[model samples]
Target: MKHRRLEVFLEFLFFGLVMGITEDLIALKFATGEPLTWKIILIVFLVALPFAIIGELIVDRVRWWRKIRRTFQKHVSSVKSSRK
Candidate 1:
């Protein structure tokens, strides 16, 4: 269980870091045409820190996802039954 959590954490962290750097680079470049520097890269990492935490805590929760899926399925089945 703990190993699963660690795997998810590392996965999210890597994705967040990659996406953060790419997004910030494009936005900053187009918005200001500023050159990429070590400072900017560091800032991007800082901004993505919270995203990593959120992914680990909220996105990785299987129980919450399952609840959401169940609710959606119920709603869909009800709609189908009404149409029949």
Candidate 2:
């Protein structure tokens, strides 16, 4: 369990880093009419950071939702009497 947790942590870290760099590059290209270095950093922080955070939160919620669904289904079945 601990090993799996560490692997998930590393995976999310790499994902966030890649997302940040990719967003910075896209922002740089879009800002061709203006300065790049500053725009890249600003966009990475302003756009990518929030996006990653929200994405992670959404994924976490989905996992929780699945768990709750399974539990609710189990409870519903248990409360019903089936002729088996």
Candidate 3:
């Protein structure tokens, strides 16, 4: 169980590292016209590392999203009922 969690985390970390570098490099190229540098790569890595974990958490955890959707649905139903 523990090993599975670690494996998933590492997977996301690797995914984030690759995705972040690609997206950041493209953005930097078009947005700033700045040349790629070690500093920029390091910065992208730093930003993406935490986001990878966060993305995993957000995607993995659907309970909160379901709750929010239910609440919204209830609210819309109530509004419709009131109108009718």
Give me the candidate number with maximum TM-score: 3
Q: What is the overall TM-score of model 2 with all chains considered together?
A: 0.46
Per-residue lDDT value at 45 in model 2:
71
Instruction: Give the per-residue Cα lDDT of candidate 2 at 16.
Output: 81
lDDT of each: 0.85, 0.71, 0.84
Error of 2 at 27 (Å): 4.0
Model 1 segments more than 4 A misplaced: 69-84
Off by over 4 Å in 3: 1-6
Runs in model 2 deviating more than 4 A are 60-62, 65-84
Write candidate 3's Cα lDDT for 9-75 as tens digits. 7887788778977897898889998898999989987887777777777765678789889999999
Worst 10 residues of 1 by lDDT: 48-57
TM-score per candidate, chains pooled: 0.64, 0.46, 0.71
Residue-level lDDT of model 1, residues 1-84, one tens digit each, is: 999978867887788778877887899899998898999988887887787778767887888899999999999999999999
Q: Write the per-residue lDDT of candidate 2 for residues 1-84, one digit (tens) a residue.
A: 999976776678569867786867776677775555775576667767666666566655568789889999988888785633
Q: What is candidate 2's CA lDDT for residue 75?
A: 83
Ten contiguous residues with the weakest lDDT in model 2: 52-61
RMSD for each of the candidates: 2.8, 5.7, 2.3
